[model samples]
Target chain A: EPEVTQTPSHQVTQMGQEVILRCVPISNHLYFYWYRQILGQKVEFLVSFYNNEISEKSEIFDDQFSVERPDGSNFTLKIRSTKLEDSAMYFCASSSDSVTEAFFGQGTRLTVV
Target chain B: GIQVEQSPPDLILQEGANSTLRCNFSDSVNNLQWFHQNPWGQLINLFYIPSGTKQNGRLSATTVATERYSLLYISSSQTTDSGVYFCAVHTGGGNKLTFGTGTQLKVEL
Candidate 1:
């Protein structure tokens, strides 16, 4: 099975620093999504991208957050200024289409100090 | 906004027992998925049944789109099956998923 791959399984950064989470979605998949899970909380959707543009985003994806395909293979999420509340497990998921099963990566544990 | 609710927030069972997890949606949806979050926090896709029934080994799932609910059945549960089960739904007209808190299952030997 082709799985989504994430870089830096765990990330630790200063509170005011910037952090970029990288994901390489399944080669053939077209849609991409970013979700986050706070410890002991439900998974929350951050943003969804298709055709190189954001299809939708949650309130959590505010001015500080941005996502880009960058190229044909990489999907990246960057947080301009990190905060203590930003610490969470960020997950990357991809699907061939909306109706199909979305595959997820192991996740990047983002920790802000 | 669509609401996803999962029942029996926590459950404990013996290794050889059977368990059923339920998920209910507030409105009609176009996509539904079941996932297992292991101890290592790896999210594993278990099923994507928007409607009808499907089975894979000791696991089976059924979704009734019209009724807006889904069920995940784990038979002959094992210690390895202990994890958090999540149900997420994609409401019609939106690509984002709304997830329930999830059911935490513990299978003991």
Candidate 2:
């Protein structure tokens, strides 16, 4: 099965600095999502995007967070300013439909200092 | 939001042993997926069974949607099976996925 791919498997950034996590979703998927998992914690959904617009987002996905599909097949999550608490593994996922199976990427480990 | 609970928070088994893992959901979901997190922290999806049954090699899964539960069976597990098993559910109500705490399995060879 085809899988989603994420860049910069490991990222280390300074607090208050800006960063962008990129993903190339499955070639034929329709919906895109971003989820984060803090070490030893359950995964939490951040936002979902479809048709070039955000469909839903969790409270954790606030003004500081933004997602854009700058071009076909490429999705990105940008954090305006990083925080120490933001250190975690970020996963990207894609589904053929909103209510169906989703393929997840290996994840990008972001360490904010 | 849906509540997902996984039983047997941790397990230890000798290589070539059989084991069963369970997942219970609080509500109805359109889709459910099982994932294994390796020691390196990469999630490898094992199944995407919303209902009924599916098998792959020595692994099999069955979901009784009516009972709101799912079971994963690993026959003759090996040392490679040692990892954290997680179940995630997504209801049509929202795009967010509610995940269980996961079961940490250790297989001793």
Candidate 3:
């Protein structure tokens, strides 16, 4: 079965530095998303991307966050300046359509110090 | 925004036992899915039952769209079933999935 794949299973960055989390969703999927989970908290939606544009974003996806589909296969989330509170597990998911079963990647653990 | 609530925030079960986890949503949804987050923190898709019932091996799920609730049944659970189960829904008019609080299950031998 084809699955979503994320790069750099774990990352450590300075509090004021930038970080880019990359994901390659399933080959034929059309809709992509980014979600984060703070330790011991529920998974929260960040943003959804389709047709090279963001469809919807949550409050957590503020000015510091941006997503890009620079190529046909890569979806990335960039944080301009990381904060201690930004530490969490970031998951990338994709689906064939808005109403289809979305599959998730293993997740990238972002730790800011 | 929609509210997703899961029952029994935590559970402990012995190997070979059976259990049911429930999820309730505040509004109608276009899609409903069940996922298991293992110790490695990977969200594994278990089911995508927006309505009706579907079974996959030891796991089965049922969603009643009109009632706005979904149930996940685990039969003859094993130690490998220990993890956090999350129920997520795609509310009408939105493309993002809203995840529930999750139910943490620990199965011991």
The candidate that achieves the highest DockQ relative to the unseen native structure: 3
True A-B contacts kept by model 1? 0.82
Candidate 2 Cα misplacement greater than 4 A, ranges = none
DockQ of each candidate, alpha-carbon based: 0.83, 0.79, 0.93
lDDT of 3 at A97: 93
For model 2 chain A, give the 10-residue run with minimal summed lDDT. Answer: A97-106
Task: List pairs with backbone clashes in candidate 3.
Answer: none
Question: What are the TM-scores, per candidate, against the unseen true structure?
Answer: 0.98, 0.98, 0.99
lDDT of 2 by residue, B1-109 (tens): 7899998899999999999999999998888899999998888989999999999999999999889999999999999999999999888778877789899999998
Tens digits of per-residue lDDT, candidate 1, A31-70, equal 9999999998999999999998999999999999999999
Tens digits of per-residue lDDT for model 3, A1-113: 89999998999999999999999999999999999999999999999999999999999999999999999999999999899999999999999998899999999999999
Best by TM-score: 3
Best by lDDT: 3
Q: What lDDT tens digits, residue by residue, belong to model 3 across residues B28-93?
A: 998999999999999999999999999999999999999999999999999999999999999778
RMSD of 1: 0.8
TM-score of chain A of each: 0.98, 0.98, 0.99
Give the poorly placed runs of model 1, Cα more than 4 Å off: none
lDDT of 1 at B38: 97
- Docking category of candidate 3: high
lDDT score, candidate 2, position B77: 95
